[model samples]
Target: DLDLSGTVGAMLRSTGGTSAPIFGFGIVDTATDVKVTLNDTNAFMVKGSVTEADLGFDNFRFGIDDNAPRMIFEDFGGTTWQLDSNGNNFRFFQAGSVKMQLASDGDLSLENNNLDNVGVIFLKQQASADADVPAYGQIWTKTATPNQLWFTPDGGVDTQLDHTGAFPTTWSDTGITGAELETLSDTSDADSLHSHSNHGASHGNTLDEAYDEGGAGAGRTITVDDGSPIELIAAGPTTKVIDILQSGGGFPELQLRPDGILFGPGGGTPQDISLTRSGNNVLALGASDKLTLDKIGATTGDVLAVQSTLKLAKPLVLDKGTSANIDGNDEISIPVVTWLYLTSAGATDNLDGIGAGTEGQVVFLTVVAGKDITLVHNGTVTAGKKLMINGEATVTLDQDHDFAIAIYDATATVWNVLVPGSGGGVGNHNILDGSVHQDSVADGVTAGSVIIGNDTPKWDELVISIPGANILNVLGIANGETVPSWKSVLDGTNPAATAATASPGTSLISAHRDHVHPIGVGTTRGDILIWNSTPVASRLVAKTAGAYVGGDGTDVVSTIPKRTIVLTAAGGKEATTAGCAAAAVVEAGTNDVDYWVLDFDKDTDEFAFWNIVMPGNYDGGTITFRVYWTAASGSGTVVWNLKGRSYADSAAIDQAYTDVGETSTDTLITAGDVHISPESAVVTLNGSPAGGEYVQIKVNRDISEDTLTADARLLAIEIEYTTDAISDAI
Candidate 1:
C-alpha cells in the first residue's frame, strides 16, 4: 500500500476531576454511516449518513432493557416525527404510580378506573381573566360530602351549599321589610305596626277619617260636595234612620210638632201634617170639615147622593141553606126550608155570608116545595126584621108558599118581610089582568085550544085527528079538482103522501103511451148489433172477416179484426255446410289452418234468424282459433280469435269470445257459443249473423310450433232462420 494513515481513533480527555469521557464514538452493523458521536459541546448525536438510503430514512432511537426502542425519531417521506411505545403497545403512556395510556388502537385507559369503581374524573378549566369565569373554573368531583357542596367564584368568597333543612331559611326582595314579613305570618302580633296599615298616598286608605291618627269612637262628619240636597224617607223616619254609634250610642234625635205639623230646622212657616179626621162615619182632609152618612146617601159640602136598586141578570139559586155572600142586587134562594138563618151581613154582594143591603133594600124569599118557611137573620135579628102584610108585622113567609119580598133597615140592621095579604095575597099566581104577567086567555075559562103566553094567554093553533078517512075527502074536494099539496109529496109506500099535479097516483103506466119494448137476443162471438131502418129496432149482424166485436152502447155494437202473422222456422229452408279446411285434422307441421266456412243463402239470409250454429272443438296448446265474417258481396271482413286453456270455465270462455283475436289454447267462445264440453264447442252466431245479407263465415286456427295439436275442427253449421219476411219479423 502506498498510502499511509496515522490515527484510527481520537479522544478528548476531561479537564475536571470526576468527569466521564467527554468525547466518544461508536459504529453499528459494521456501517460507518450509521454511528453515534459524543463530544464535550454536543450531547449524543446519532445519525445515518445520506448514503444509507436503504434504511428509507434516518432514525434516532433510545431504549432500555433489551435495548428495544422505547422512543424513536424518524424522518420519512419528508415528514419527521417521534413515536413512543409503552410495553403494552400503547401510543401514549403515563409513568405514574397508577398507569394510564392511550393505546395504539385509540383506546384511552386508566388503571383501576371504571364506571362501577371510582367514577371520578375531574374536568377542570384553566384560569381566565373574565370575571364571569372562576379562577379554577369548573371542577367535577364525585367524592364530595352528602348534601354539601363547595362553590367558589373567581372574585368572590367561597360558599358552601347545604341542603340540610326545610326550603327557605331567609328570603330577601326589593321593597320588602320585616314589617311586611310580619303581615305575612299569622303567628306575628296582629296589632303590630304592619297590621292593616294604610299604604299612604301611594296606595289607598280604607278609613274615612282621612288620616291615620283618628282615635277610636271619634266623631267625624262626611260632607258631600254634590249639589242636590239629601232626601229622607217621608214615613217611618225612626225605623229608617241609620244609628251610627256603638250599641245604642244614639244618633241625633228629631223633634216632633205637637200640633201634628212638621217644619224644617230653619223653616219660615208652620205646616199641618195631621192624618186624622173627626167625623163619626166620614173622612175629612181639612181641620174644619165634616162628613155625614145616611142610608144610601152622603152629604159633605156641595156633594149629594141618590139611592137606586141594583139587580143581577141571573140570580144564584141555593137549594139548601148555607153560609154564602150574596151580591148586592143579587138574590139567594132558600128552597122550601122550614127554618133559615142568614149569616154575616155586608153592604155589597159576594162580600160576606150575609146578603148585601142598605137601609130599605129589599130581597125575596121563596118556598119552592109548597111549604111555609120561617126566615131569621142569624146576624142581628130585631123588631125591624119583622114582615108586614097589609102593613102589619109578620114573622113567616106568605101562606101561598111561593115567595115573600122584604126590605133591609140599615138603622136597625134588620130585614122586614112583607106578609102575603099585605101585598094582594102574594100574587105568585096572578089572574089574567092587563096589569102584569097576565095570560091572554080568560081566567077560569076551559077550552080544547092551545094557549100561548104573553103576560096573557091566547089560542095559537088547533090539531084534530080523524080515523079511516082520506085527506082529500076530509077536505071535501070534488073529482077533477086539485088541492095545494106541494109540500106534501110522497114517494112509493111513504106514510105521508103528497099530491102532484100531473102524476098524482103511484102507477107510472098511466103516464106513458103503449109501445112494444123488444129486448135484445143472445150475441155470438163476433156478432155486432145494428139498427134496422124499417123496424127501427136493434138486430144482430154477423161480423165480417178480419173484424172484432165490442159494445158501443145498448144497440150500437161494432168490431174490428187484425191479422196475426207468427214467424216459424221453415224446415229445410236454411242450409249449412262445413267451414274452414277440407278435413278436421290439422297435421303437426301446419302453423295455421282454415277450419270452418259458412256459405250464406240469399233466400234465408235475407230474413231475421235465431242463430248460425257451428259445431267445433280444439285440442292444442297456445292455439288461436279465429272466426272471420264477410259482409254481403264480400265487401268487408271481421276476424276474432278465442282465448284460454282447454279446461277454462264458462266465464273464461265468455271472456275469450269477447277478446277477439286473442291467442290461447282453449276457451274459444261466448255463452251462446255453446261449449257443451271440451270436445264439443258449438259457436252460435247470435241473431247478428249477417242477417238480410249474403255472408260467408270462416274459422281459422293459428297454432304455435310447440302446440300439442296443430288444428281445430268445425263440424256442420246450421242456420236457424225464420221463414217470415223481414218486413213482418223482429
Candidate 2:
C-alpha cells in the first residue's frame, strides 16, 4: 500500500541516443510520503523533465505496485493534486500532429476548452456494465462533425432511406446524382421498351362512339317508295276509303307530322277513316276495313249511322222476324205469353184471360182463391187508401186479429206498430190499441146484511127508545145484565102476555160496562188506585190511635213518705247521750223499747236491725235483757239478755272503805291475799258474767242506733226480793 503524507518536488531526465531514451518511474516504498515534481525550482512536479545540455526523453511512464495506487496522496495536508501511478505530476504536451493521450473505458471529457483544429475524429468502445442500450442494437461512436456522438450499425445497409438505387457504394457516396441511374439500366433488346406489349393503346375505341355506330343498321327507320297506291272511300255514302297493306302481319305504321296531324301509309291522300282517341293520343282508322271479327254477325259494312232504327226480334236478337201488336186497347198483346201481373185482382176474376175494356176504365181482375191480393200503387194515396163500406157492411175479426201496419221514421226504414188500440199518427203512436182492455167490469161487489133464521119479536128484540141515548149508550146497555123487575106481571106486571122486565136497580149500570166512561171514575179500582188511597187518612188515623203512650199523672208518686220513731225509756227517763252511749242502761223492773218504725215513700216498706252487747267483769252477777219490736200487724220479742253479779259486801257499797270486807259483810267482791301480777289479767266473760261491785267493767258492742242492743253489767247489790204473803207473816 502507498501512504502519501507530504509534498515533494523533483525532476528526472533521460539523455537521448539511437535507441530513444525511455524513462520509467516506480514507487519504491509505497508507504512513504513522496511526490514527484516536474522541476526543483518551480515547487511543482512534472512527470518527466529536460535538462540544459541534452535533449530529454519525449515520453515517460510511471507505475506503482500497491493494490490501491490512489492511496499515495490520501493524507496530504494541502489542497489535493492529482497524480499518476508513480506519484508524478500529470502533464500534457503536443508537437505538431502528435500528442500525448489519455484514455479510459468510460467517458473522456475535456473541460474548459473548445477543440477546434481537428478535421475528423472517432471514438470506439463497447458499452460499460452500467450503460443503457437502445432497442435497435447500435454501436457507440465519437466523431468530430455533424452528430458529435451517435450509435450506428456496422454494415452499409442503411434502413432509413429508399432502396431504388444500387446500395452500399451508392449509399456511402455523398456526391452521387441522377445520371448514375442510366448507367444501371440494361442494354439488351429483349429488355428494352418494345419487348413489353402496349396494353394502354390496345382497345382504342371509347364506349359512346361504339354504341352510336352499332345502332346504325338496326331496324328503327321508316321509308316510303313512289309506287304505293292510294284509294278513296267514305265511311257512309259520303265517307272515303283507302287500303293499307300490312306486311309481316302487323299493324300498319303511321307517322305524325310536327304540325300535330297524322298521315296514313298512302302518304298525303284522303282515306276512308274514322278518328278515335286512345287515352290522350288520337288514332285514325280506314272506315270499310274490318281489323278483326269480334262476333259472327259483325260485317265490314255494319258501321253505325246517325238516325237509323234497330229492331230486335225479342229484345236483343237480330232478324228473328216475329210480330207484336200494340193495338188501340192500350195494351201490348203477344201470343201465348205467360206474364206476371203485379196488381191486385178480385177473388172471382181470372188474371190469365182478361178481356180488354174501354180505354181509361177501371177494371177488376180476379186472382185464384186463397191467394193474397197485392196492390202496388206507384204514388201515395192522398186521403189514405180506404176500403169504403156501403150499407151495413162490417169488418169483424173472426178469430184472433193480427193487424200489422208498417210505419217509417225520418230515415225511411220501416217499423211495425204494436200499440193495443188503433195506431194514431205517423211514428208518434207505434203502440196500436195499447190502452184497450178486454174485460171492462169492476173488480168486486158489496151487498147488505145476511140473515140465517127467523124468530118472533120479543121485548128484548124490539128497539127501545131512551131519552138522550147515543150509540155508546146502546152498546153499554147491550152488554149489560138482563134482570126482571116488579112492574112486569106479578111483580107489577105489564098487560102484554109475554113481557120481560128491565129492573132499574139490578140492571147493569151505564158507567160500569161502558168503555167510553172515564177510567178511574167508573171502572173497578186497579191496584195503583187502591195503593194510592191506603196510606192516606185511614192508615194515618189507625197508626196514631194505636201507638203506645207513656204513664199517666195520677199513677205517679209525688213524694216519698218517711216514717218517724220516738225513743221511750222504761222509767220514763231519757239518756243524756243522743247517739249510742256506753253509760245508758235499763232499770231493774223497767224495760227500754227502741221504736223501729219503717217508712216507705212508695207502697212498700222494709226494715232490718241487729245489736250485740259485751259483759263486764262482775263475778256471779246476773243481768237479763230482752228486745221487742212493733210492726204494722203485730209485735214480737226479738232477743233477750240476763246477767247477775255477786259482790263481797252489800254495805261496802255505801262505806268509805279502802277494801271490801268479807264474812259478815259478805263482800261479794273480795281481795284475798291481794297479789298483783305484771302481765294482763284476762277475765273471759262467757255465758252470762257474774255481777260485781267495785268491779272493772269492759263492754264491747258492735251496733248502730238503728240496730237492737242488750244491757249487761257487773254490780254490788243486796238481795232484798220477797213475796207479799211471806213478808206479811214475818
Candidate 3:
C-alpha cells in the first residue's frame, strides 16, 4: 500500500545512519544478502548472490534461469569479456567478438580475429587444394594433399616435391636415371643397398626378396651333416646367442631330438625326467603311474582328459598354507597352491576375492576364526586381477569352522563356486546335510594338532526318545532345594499310600538344602504373586489402578488400566466475555478424516476455554494435558506456548494469570502437518482437585514471538489423571 501525497516526485531520506535501509521486507541475516543502504556519495550499490535481492522474498528464484540475460564483464585495462548463448552452445566473447564457443555435445571451438576463419597464421602460407597458387619462391602446403610440399618457383606454376614427411626427399635434385637404377638393382646388396631401396635384391631387380622379419622370405639354403659340421651363425667372432622363439604366448615351440628327452624350464638348466616309455603310455610315477592322456572326441573340449584311472597310496598335500589375514577389501593374492587358510582376522579381514588362477584349477579356502565372510558374488573386478566368485545361489561362511571350494573358469574369467561336500574339502561341517563334520581339522590354536567336534550352526528343535513304556522315574530334586521331612515317615517305597502318619507342615524343607519354602500371602486363586518367604524372588507386577491384596488362599488380585480423560475441540468453546480474542471452531474434511478445528492465529493471542468435570473415582491428583494440532499453511518452526488457568471455584474468573506455564516447540517439516506433544509436566489443578468439582482450562496461542507463518488448527487435547475406582458411585 502506497500513498504518494500527490507530489510531483518521490524521494526517500535515511532516518538514521548510512546502514539504515529505507525500504525492504522479509528480513534475513546479512552474510548472503544486504539491504540497499545509501551513503553520502550515493553510488546506489547492492551486490548479493542474486541478480536482484528483492525477488527471493516472494518465492521466486534468484539464480540463472529462463528469465536471466547474458552476463558481461568489462575491463578498464583493455576490452570486455562476455558469457552468452550461441543457439544451443555457450559462447565467450572478447572485445565484442566471439573468442570461444562450447557446444552442448562437449565440442569446443576456438576462433581467430578474422570473422570468416577460425585458425592461427604462421610466417609461411598454409593453403588448401582449392586455394590460389602462392607467390614466387614461397613454400606452402595444400590441405587436400598436405604431405606434398609445393612452391611457386617462378610465381606462376607450383613445383612438385616429395610426398613423404621424412627428411632428404626420396627424389634428389642430382637425379639418377632409371636405366642406371635398374643396373644397380640386380647385382648389389651393400654395394647398392643402404642400397636396397633404390634397387631390388636379386642383383636388386625386385623389392620382394629384400628381407626383414615382417613376412616369409626367399632365402639361400645350406646342407650339413655331423661329419661335415658347418658354422650356421656367427656374430663377428664374439660369443652370442641364437634363439628359436615363438612370436607370442599361447603359441607352442617344439624341438625334436632323435635320442633324448629334456625336462626343464627355459633359459635355466635342463634335466631328464627319469621315466621310460612303456606299452604306449608314460612310465610310472606318483599316483599317475603309466599316465595316458587321450582326447575325448573331436566335438568335446577339454583341458586334458585323463582316460586312465589314477590312485595314490599316500595322502595328497593340498598346500603349504598358514593362516593369512586378508586386506580391507577382503582380497588376497592366491598363489598356484591348491589350498589357502583364511582365518584369524588381523584388524579387519573378510575374504571377498582371490587373485591369480588358471583354468580347471580347484581351490579350497579355510574360513575360520571369529570374522565372518560375505562373498561379493560376481565381484572381483580390479584392474590386472583375475579372480572372481560367481554363483547362482548366495553363500555366507558365518561359522568359525567353514571352508569354501571353487574352481577357476578361465574362459569366463570367473571362479565357479562349489559346495564343500562335492569335493575333498576337509571342513568341519557337511554341506549336503546339516550334520556335524566329523573330520579331523587342524586346530589353529595349537600347531599340528587335530580337533574334532560338531561346530556346525544348526539349532532346530531337538526331541528325546525313550525305549520303554511310561514307567520312567525322575529324581526331581532342584539345586539348593530339600525334600519335606514328613515324607520320610510315609512308606519309603510307596509315598502315594495314605500317609496319615502325620500331615507334612507347610514349612517343608528341600531334600538337599535347609532353605524354607517361600510364597506370597494372597488369597485370590487366579492371581499370581512373587516368592516372598522373607527374602526370596524379587519380582513385582506393575499395578496401574488397584493394589495387591491377600485374598482367599493367598493369591494376588491386581488391576492394570489407567484412567484417561480425552477432550475434543467439539466439546470446547471460545470465551464469551469482552476484551478477549477467542478462536472459532470450524469443521474440516470429509469421511477420510474429520477434525473440529479450533483456529489459533499466528499474530495475536487467541483463547479457548474448556471445563472438565471429574469422576467420583478421581484420585485428587495433579493432571497433565497433551495437545494435538496442525498447521493451516506454510512450513516452519511452530511454538505451542500455552498456559492453562485451572481454577475450580471460589476464585474470580478475571484474575491475573501466571506469566508462562507449559511450552512446547516443534516444526511442521512437510508444510501442512499434525503434531501431538508429550504430556505437559505436572499441571496442578486449582483449589484442591476433588470429585464433583469442575476445572476450567484456558488455552491461548502466545504467537507474539513465534515464527509460524500461518494459523494453527487445534485438533484435540488429552487430559489424563489418576483414578482408584471404576465408577463415580464406588
Candidate 4:
C-alpha cells in the first residue's frame, strides 16, 4: 500500500513511455472534513464521512505526470484500490481471476465470463480393478449422432467384455470366461422336495371300503317317518279347546284322530277335533271344533245370572241361543237389549197386541217386511203409499169431513195426494163427476167444459135459462132470417095487423087492395094511406049527361037585369061598339094598392089606357109579371111602351118601345129590359131589332129571328135593375 500522507505537489512522476500502465491523472480534493483549495478563492470539499488520514494534508495538491501509474481510493472503506486517469475512477483488484470493472456512471461490475465444453465427462471406476465395478447413478450425455453403450462378455468362466465386435455390441452373460453359474431355488417350500412320494395319497386317492358299501356310518339320507300319534290336551285357558296339525301331500287330507291332542297339565281332557280343507291349501275348523261353553246348572250361574242389581253401562247383547229369565217377585228390573222379539200371530192383529195401556204413547217398532200395517177406521182415514193397509180394511168417512194424505217419493220428499179421474174422460168424453154435490164449488177450471148441454149449449141456443121460460123453449134458428117461427109458445100480447081492403064493406075485406099510397099534404110527399076524412072525388064518373063533352068545355051562363042582349056581328063582336061608351073611371083614392085600367083597342089593334095613373118614374126598380103584346102588320119601326130613356141622350124618352130590325117584322115581348141607369137599358133584344124606321123591336124574348115566324106567341116578362147606382157602380 502506497501512502500519500504529506504530498505537496508530485510524489511520483513519469514521462510518457510506450509500455507504461498510465495515461494521465489528477488529485481531487475528496475531503469531507475541511475544504481544500489550490488557490484561496477556488476551494472544493467532498461529501461523505472523512478523517485526516483520508487526505494527506488539508490543502495539499497531488498530480501525476504522463506515463505514470496513479493510485486511487475507490471507496471510503479503504479496502478497494483503482487506477486514476484524468480524474476518472477505474477499479482494480490484485487477483486477476477476480475483476472489478467500472461503469461510465461509477457503478462497479464483478462477474465471471466462461464457456463449457461439448462432451460428457463421466467420473468412472478404473478398468483394472479386480473387484466389481460400482455403478454410478444414471449419467445423461449429449452426442452428435444416435449411440448406445452396451456390455458383451466373452466365453470364459469369469464374465468379461469382448471388444472384438463393433462399437454397439450386446454383452450378455452367455459364453463368458470366469462367468458364475446362475442357480434358482424355491425357498417357500423346502420340505416339498423331500415329500414327493406322499403327494397322490394326500389328495384323497385312498378310501375305506366299508363306507362305500352302506355301512352304519353312511351319510345321512333324507327321510320322513310317520310321527307317533300324539295326544294334545288343551285345558287351562278355557273349558273348550281346539288344536290343528298340518298335513302334506296328495289330497292334503285332514284326519280328526279319535285320540285327540291333549293340552294343559297332564292332558286330562281331550278337545273335540275336526278338520276341513278350504281352497288354496288352507284348512278350517268345522263347527264341531268351535269352542262352546256348557250350560251350567242354576246354582253354578248357568245363564250368566246376575243375582244382584246389575246396571248395564253399555248395551248388552245375547247372540242366537242366549236368553234370560226373571225369577224374583216385585222386581223392577231393567236390562238394555237390542233386536228383541215379542210374539205375535198375524201382523194385522199385531198392532192391537201393544196393549191399551200404551195408548196415546209413542213406540218405535222396526218392521222387517213391507206392507206390514193394516189400520181399520170407521171414520175418515187418510193413508199414504207407505201405509199399506189391507184392501178389505175399510176406511170409512162417517160424516162430511176433509181428508188429506201425503206420499213420500224415492228421495223421501212428500208430494200431494193425486186423485184418480182428475183428467177428463177418454176420447174427449165427460169423465169427472165434479157435481158430486149440487152446489159444488170447483175452482181453477181454466178449460171450458165439453159436455153438450151441461155448460156449453147447442149452436145458437142460449145456455142461461131465462126467467119463467125453459131452456128448451128457446128456438134454434138459422142466421140472417127476418123472422124465424117460434118453436115454443109466445107470451104477452099479440101485435096488430093491417087490413087488405080500401073500402069498408068490400066483401068482408077479402083480398082488398090496401095499396101504400103517397100524398103531398103541404110541400112534403111520403107513404100515405086513406084516413078518416072527406072524399074529394068520386070513384067513377057516370054518363048521365048523355053526350060527352065535345072539346074542353067552357060555357058561362048568367042572369042579367033584362038589358042583357045578344049582339052578334059579322066576324066577332070585336068591341063593335068600342067607342060607343068609354069612360075614364078612376076609382076612389086607393091606399097603397091600386089598379090602373088599360084597354086593348081591338078595332085599332092598339093598347090604350083610360084614366091610367102611372106612378112616378123610379130611377132603379125592377118589374116582374106577365105582359102580353102582339105585333100588327107593319113594315116600319113601331114604338111600343118603354120605361127607360135613350142611351145616346138622356132627354130622349119614349113611352113605346124602340126597335131596330132589318125586315118588316112583328115581335112579342116576353121579358122586359133590365135598365142599369136611367140613360141606359140593358136589353137582351129578342128576335132581330129592325135597323131602320118602321122596324119592330122585340125585347125580353128568347126567340131567334132566324127561326121564328110571324106567329110566335108571347109569354111573361122579367127584369132586373140596380137600386143604388152610385154604390152599385163602385
lDDT of each: 0.32, 0.25, 0.48, 0.27
lDDT of 2 by residue, 126-158 (tens): 321123334333334333233223323232111
All candidates: CA RMSD in angstroms? 39.1, 53.4, 40.5, 46.3
The candidate scoring highest on TM-score is 3
By summed lDDT, which 10 consecutive residues of candidate 3 come out lowest?
194-203
Task: Sort all candidates by lDDT, best to worst.
Answer: 3, 1, 4, 2
Best by lDDT: 3
lDDT tens per residue, model 3, 100-146: 89989755666764445478734333552223434324355544333
Q: Write the residue-wise lDDT of candidate 4 on 1-730 in tens digits.
A: 1224334222232223323222212332555233232222222223234443333313333334265444434344435343444335465543333355576764444546342569864533332212222432122222213322223112111222323322112222222111111110122211111100011211111112213323444322312224422222333443223222222122222222333333222233333222224523223444445433344232422243334466544454433221222112211112122222221233322221121111112222222222132222122222321222222222211111212132223343222222121111111222333332212233222243222232222212223334353212333344564433333334333323433334543221122133343332433232223322243221222222222222223322121111111111111111233221122222334444322222233223222211111111212222222233332222222222322222222223234443331222233332221111122234332222211111112222222322222322122122332222112211
Score residue 100 of candidate 3 by CA lDDT.
Answer: 87
Candidate 3 regions off by >4 Å? 1-535, 538-545, 548-561, 577-594, 641-660, 728-730
Quote each prediction's TM-score: 0.15, 0.10, 0.27, 0.11
Off by over 4 Å in 2: 1-106, 125-139, 142-730
lDDT for each residue of candidate 1 in 538-607, tens digit (9 for 90 to 100): 4566555323446555534445421221212221122233223232222223455433323333212111
TM-score of predicted model 1?
A: 0.15
